[model samples]
Target: MGPYSGSKSYSGGEIMGLKVFFSVLAVSVAISGCAKSPPPAPNHLIMLTETADGQADASFMEVDTLEECESRASAAKKVFPMAKIKYIRHYCTHTNIKFEPFLHNPEPEGPSYVFGLNFVKDGKVLSKVSNFKSMTDCENKGKQVCVISYQNIVPGE
Candidate 1:
């Protein structure tokens, strides 16, 4: 009977309310879509050391970043404090890779060089390559846009 009572129409206030509801919903969805996912779980670094008698020992510790692993590796002596250590190697790889293989042949085959290559993009090492005949060979083998640097692995003092 009234102007809008019988008509299937919405009032200006009702339409505005609907618009506001939809706008809020749209904003919420957009914000959620743009939200970043939680960071990945930290990876573990395997600190392996070989003694003079050809005994290999490894200790696993969770490292939040690769830089921490490098720092720990640099201070291998203080960390392990073992005498007559032939070599101490720090390797950080994906969890899927089995570390048992590393412990088997801890010693290098011949007179070779061990180089540390840290990938720049992810600030993590993809793999460890040792037994390079020369520094030039190591550098050449690690030629990649993402490679940050290749440092000779010096036994921690």
Candidate 2:
């Protein structure tokens, strides 16, 4: 038998090698198509004034567009009516903020806020005072950290 007599084995190996190479190429193409796109630019901006201690001083609002950023500053006069608008920040994008179909609170009559004061000593929660009606009430308890939780429900138009 000549060298060509065993050519079936060589051709079989070549076919198997080609199949493995094509399989890897197909997987790489599929993964590239499944890659996530970058997030879109923020559509709305939030303006707020900061206190000396870097905390927002009762002034914050979300705007619709970049052009209205200046006009919104004038509108904020009704909230503070004295404090000037100094800090403007991009907060939400069109894709990020989605309207909920159902209401958070169906009745919407009782206290809509829950404030809690937590005292932590050496990475441990020593004591926690919760269920305060307002921020001032939670502050009166006097803890290292205060956690405020509240949700707003808007009726469908």
**Residue 102, model 1, lDDT:** 24
Model 2 TM = 0.36
The per-model lDDT (C-alpha) reads 0.49, 0.43
- Top candidate by lDDT: 1
Clashing pairs in 2: none
In model 2, which range of ten residues has the least summed lDDT? 93-102
Off by over 4 Å in 1: 1-8, 46-77, 80-100, 104-107, 110-157
Question: Model 1: per-residue lDDT, tens digit, 1-157?
Answer: 6767877788999999999999999999999999976434436565656635443434445566767766766776564555446445656543422222222233444332244343322524334434445445556766531111122233431
In candidate 1, the residue pairs with backbone N, CA or C atoms under 3 Å apart (3 or more residues apart, or in different chains) clash, namely none
Residue 139 in candidate 1, Cα distance off native in Å: 8.7
lDDT of each residue in 23-43, candidate 2, tens digit only = 999999999998976444334
lDDT, residue 74, candidate 1: 76
Superposed model 2: Cα runs more than 4 Å off? 1-10, 51-53, 57-83, 86-88, 95-157
